[model samples]
Target: MEKSVAPDNNNLAHSYNHIGGVYMNIREYSKALSSHEKALKFYEKNLPPNHPDLTTCYNNIGSVFYSMGQYSKARSSYEKALEILETANPSNHNDLATCYNNIGAMYYHTGNYSEALLFYEKALKMIEKFLPPNHNNLAHSYNNIGGVYMNMREYSKALLFHEKALNIYENTLPANHPDLATCYNNIGSMCYSMGEYSKALSFCEKALEIREKTLPPNHPSSASPVVPQNTNKNNTYLLAASWTIAVTVAALVFMPKFRELNCTSAYEGGMKAVIWTDVLQALVMLVGLLSAIIQGLIVLGGFGPTFSIASKGGRIQFDNISIDPRVRHTVWSLLIGSTFNGLSIYGFNQTQIQRYMCVRTTRGAAQALFINAVGSAFIILSSCLIGIIIYAYYADCDPYTAKFISAIDQIFPYFVMEVFSNIPGLPGVFLACIFSGSLSTISSGLNSLAAVIIEDVYKGLMRGQLSDERQGFISKIFSIILGAVVMLLTYVVSHLEPILNAATSLFGALQGPIMGVFFLGFFFPRANHRGCLVGFVSGVALPLWMLVGSQITKNQRKSERLPLFTTNCALPINETITFSSPVRSDPLLDLYSVSYLWYSPIAVSTVLLVGLIVSYLTRPLKPHAVDPKLIIPIDDVFCCYLPKSVRHWLRCGVDHENYLNERVCTEFIE
Candidate 1:
C-alpha cells in the first residue's frame, strides 16, 4: 500500500527514519544502521543527490556507525553528509560546521590526526565566519582541533587550542558546567603529557571539582584516572609536625635571649617590644589577605561580577535578623552577644590589661584602645571579605561538597593553594603570615599569664616584694611551663571540628566568669569576695555544661547546607543514574542548640544574677567600708550630666570624693 502511494515515496523514507531513531535510542545499533540505510535508499531514489534530507539520512547512518565503533564506516557516512550539505546548502554555515565537526571526530577516532586537523580547521573557519568569537560552537570546533593536536603529540599547540576553548567556556558557561569540566580535563591531559605535573594536578583537580558537582556519585568519570588523587596526606602531616617541632625547639632555645630583649619588667619595655613585633606580623597578615582578595577578584573578572554571582547564589546575606537563639548568625547575636564577648576580652583579659598598663597615661591608654579597636575591625572585615571572595570563586562548585577537602575549615588553605600555587613564594609567604600571627598571640598570652602569676598570685599570697632579677627568672620559668602545656593542648584543639567555634566557645565559657568577677569588684561595692566566688563558679559551670552538651548533640541538630547541584554533569551512556533521597531531620528543641554567640551573654547574665542574689542573702559588704579606689566611679564618668546629688545617690554610698579630688589634683600637677 505504501509503494502504491508513490514509488520511492518520501513518506516511506520518513517512516524508516522514525524507526531508525527509535532503534538508535534503544542501542540496537545494527537495527538502527539497517533502518537508516533503508531511509537513505528511499531518499536517494526520491530526491536529488544534493538534497538536505539526504544529508540528514547520511548523518544518522554515520552516528549509528560511530556508536558501533565502525570508524571506517562512520568516516564514509560523515564524508557523504559533508558532501551533500556543501552542495545543497553552502550558505548554511552552522550546518556546514556541524558536518565538518562530525567528519573530523570520525577521522580523529580512526587515528588520522592530519585528516582530523584538516576537517576541524574547516569547521572552525566556518564557525568563526558566522558565530561570535565566544560562541559555544566555536569552542566545540576549537576543542576538536585541540584533541587532534594532542593525539599528534604537538603538546604546545594542543594547549593553545585547548586554552582558547577554555577561555570561551569560562566566559560564557556556568562555573560548574560539564563542558567546562571536559575542557579542563583536556588541558590537564595536555599539561600531564608535557610533564608539567603541578599544572596538570591543578587542572585535574578543577576538572574533578566540576565533575563532582554535576555528575552522579557513581559515574565512571568520578573514578576516572584523569583526575589526580591526593596520595601525600601522610607526608603532609609529617612535614607539618616536623615544622611545628622545629619552630617550638627554636622558640624554647631562644627564650632567655627573647626575654632579655623583650621582657625587662613586664610593663613598658616588654609591652613595647611585643607591640612592635605585633605591628610587623599584622602587616604581613594584611599583605597575605589582600593578595588573596585581589587575585580572587581578578579571576572572577571583578568585584562587580563576584558580588553579583554570590548574591544570586544567596551567599551575600546579612539581613538574617531573626532572634532565634539557635540560629548561627543573627543581628541580635552579632550586636548583643559580640558586645559581651568583646567586653570580656578587652576589659578583663590579662593580655589586653598588660598592654593598657604599658601606656604612659590614661589618655594614652584610651588612644591605644581606640587604635586597637580600629585595627581589630579592619582585620575582621578583611577576613570576612576573603571568605566572600572564596565563596564567589567556588559558588558553583563547592570544594567541600566535591570531596576535595574533608572539612569546611580547610577551604581557606585549599583556596590559597589553588589560587596562589602558580605564584612563586606567595603560598609560602601566606603560610608564614599565618604562623606569625599565631606566634604573636601565643607570646602575648604567655607573657601576660606569667606576669599575672607573679604579681597577682605569688606576691599577693606571700605579702612580699621580689627583686627585678628574681621576678624575671620566675617569669621565664613560668613561660616555659606554660608553653609546654599550650603545646600539649594544641594537639587536642587541632582535632576539633571548626576550631574557631570551639575556641570561641571555650573562651566564653572560661573567660566570661572571670570577666564577671572583675565587673563585680569594680562596679558592685556590695558584692563580697564570697558572692563573687559563688557567681564565678556558677557562671563557669552553666556555660561549660551547655558547651559540652552542645558538642555531644551537635550531630543531631545539623544545620541545612546551602543548595548544591549536579544538573550539568554528563550522564554515562547506557547507565542508570539514581539520585539518593534527601535525608530528613527533626531536631529536638533544647538549650544546647543555642548559638555559640550567646554563650558569653549567658555566662555574664548568670554571674550578675547569681552574685547579686548571693550578696544580698549572705550579708553583703557595707558600701561605706569599700575602698573608693577599688570602684570604677562610673557615676562620675558616665552620669556626669546629672547633678552631684543624683550622681552621689547612684554611687551606692561609696565615698569617691577623696578619689575624685586626688585625681583632679594629680591632673592639675601634670
Candidate 2:
C-alpha cells in the first residue's frame, strides 16, 4: 500500500460495476444504465476489448434494459455479453450459464416458449458441469428449466426439475431461508396448475411458514411464494357445485318451464324468473329433507337408541374443546369457524348476494335471507339426524366389517340404495335430486365467472364501446370456455377425500378472507382499497398456510386404523381381523395443529387485524366520504341496550331518512 501504484482503471471499473448492481437492485434503471455504461467505457479504454469486466458491464446493461421493457435492446446487449463470455470460457463457466439463462428469460418474456426452453436447457447443462451439486446457482438453473416446462404444460418434467431444485436448496440453504421458500412456492404453483390441490396446498404452506419465520412484519418477503390465483379455481368450483345442485333440482321437479327459464342476463325479467325458481327449489328441497328425517326416525326406532349407538361409536363430538389445531374436530373450532364459514357463504358469496339483489325491495331481500337461514338450519339438522340413524342401523351389523361396503363413504349410499330398493321410484328421485343439484351448480358457476370476466376485466380493459347484446354474446362465449375447462378438470378430481369434508375444508380456507374483505368494506369506512387488498391477501394466505400445515402434520402422525367389528359382523374366511391399538400422537407446532373448522375464523381475525394495522400506516379514506349505505350502524348492533319504544321510534325515523338518501344517491349516481 505504501508503494506508489499506477492509477488503476480496473479498480475504477469494478467500483462502477458494484454501483450499477446496487442501482439495478433498487430499481433505479436509468442510474444503473449510466453506471454500467461508465464502467464499460473505462474497461474499453483501459483494458483489453475481450476483458471480463466489459462482459459484466454489457450483461448489467442488458438486465437494466430488460427491466425497462426495451426487449430488443436488452437482447442485443445480452448477445454482446454472451459473445464475450463464450470467447473467454468456451468449454464451461458459471458466467456462461448465467448468460444463457438471461437469454432464455428474453425469449420467455416475448412468448417464444420453445426458444426459451431451448436456452434454459442449455444453461442447465452448462451449470450441471461447472457448479457443485448443492450450489445455489445450480438450483436457480434447474428452477428456470422447470418454469419453462411448466409453461409448456409438461407437468411431470416440470415437477422433476423443480424437485431437483428443491433438493439442492434443502441441502445448501438454512431451514428458513428465503430461496427455499421461493422453491416451495414454485412447486406449489405448478402442483396447483396440475389440479393437485392437496400437494399444492402443502407446499404453499411450507413456503409461507418459512417466510413468516425468516422475514419481518410487513416485509414483502413475509408473503413470499404467495398462493397463485389458479389455486382460487377451487372456490369457484365449490360455488358452482352448490348452484348446480339447486338448479338441477328445480329443473327436474319443475320440468319444461324451469328448463326454459334463464338467469344469464342481468335483466329485470330474468332476475325475477330466477328468484321465483329459487324459491320453488328451496321448498322442494325442504320437503325432501323433512321426508328423509321422518323416514330415518322411523327406521332407527326413535331418537333414544340412535343417540345411544352414535355415542357408543364416538361419532358425537359436541364437547371437544382441545386447543390443538391438529385435532380433527373441536367445539371452539366448529362453532367459531363454521359460523364464519356460514356467514361468508351466505353474506359475501356472489351467488347469495346476486339472489338478494334480485328481490324487489330490501324487506323482500331480508325475507329471502331469513328463508335461506331457516332452510340451511333444517338441512343441517336433517343431516345430523340421518347420520345418527345410519350409525344406529350399522352399529350392530357394521357394514364395512361385514364386507358389505369398501369404505366409510360408501356406507351412506349403500344404505340409501338398500333402504329404497323396494320403495317405488324413491331411489330414482334421490339420484335425480343429486344430478339436478350438480347441474345447477355448474351452470351458475359458468354464468357468474363469465359475468365477472366480461364486466370487470374485459370491459374495463377495452376502450371501444360495446353494445349490451355484444357484451352478452362475449359473456356467453366465456361461459362455454369456463364450463369446458372445468369439465376437463373433473377427471383430476379422482382419489379425493370425502366430498363433504373436502368441500368444507376448501370453503373454510377460501371464505374467511373473502368475508373479511366484505366486513372491512361495510364496517370499516376508513379502510382504503389498498389496505383492504393487503388484508384480504394476507387473510387468505395465512389460513392456507395453517390448513395445509395442519393437514400434512396430521397425515404424518396418522394412526393405523384397526378393522371395525360387531357381534353380527361377517368376514371372509381368509381375512384375519386385528383391533386398533392406541398410538400416542407426536406433538406438533402450535400453528400446524389447529382444527380445520377454525380456518375461517382465524382468517377473518387475521384480515381484520392486519387490515387495521396496515390502514393506520397508510392514508385512510375519510369516513364521511364513504357510501353511507355501506356502513353498518352502531345502533343496530347494540339495539338490545335501547328500550323497545325507543328502538321502534329510532327505526321509523332513521329508516325513512336512509331510504330517501339512498333514492337520491341512486338517481345522482345513475
Which candidate's TM-score is highest? 1
Question: What TM-score would you give candidate 1 relative to the actual structure?
Answer: 0.61
- Candidate 2 ranges with C-alpha deviation above 4 Å: 1-291, 316-318, 321-326, 400-403, 489-493, 558-567, 574-590, 622-629, 633-670
Candidate 1, 243: how far from true, in Å? 10
lDDT of each: 0.77, 0.68
What are the per-residue Cα lDDT tens digits for candidate 1 across 1-670?
A: 4656676668888888999999987667779988989889888888988999998998898777655545445657777888877777889889887766665655564457797789788878888988889888888777877877877899999999989999999999999988888888888888878877678778888888887887655343543434344323465688789889988987888666656676432342455666777777889988888888887887777889888867865677789999889887788998988898899889888898888888889899999899989989988998888888887776545565444456888888878877775687798878977887887888788888888888879888877778888887888788888889999998978766598899888888998888888887888888887789899999999998988878766655645444432222332111111112223443443788888888988888788889988998999999878989889877877888998899888898998997879989998999
Local distance difference test, candidate 2: 0.68
Give each model a TM-score. 0.61, 0.53
RMSD (Cα, Å) of model 1: 17.6
Could you give the C-alpha RMSD of every candidate to the true structure, in order shown?
A: 17.6, 23.6
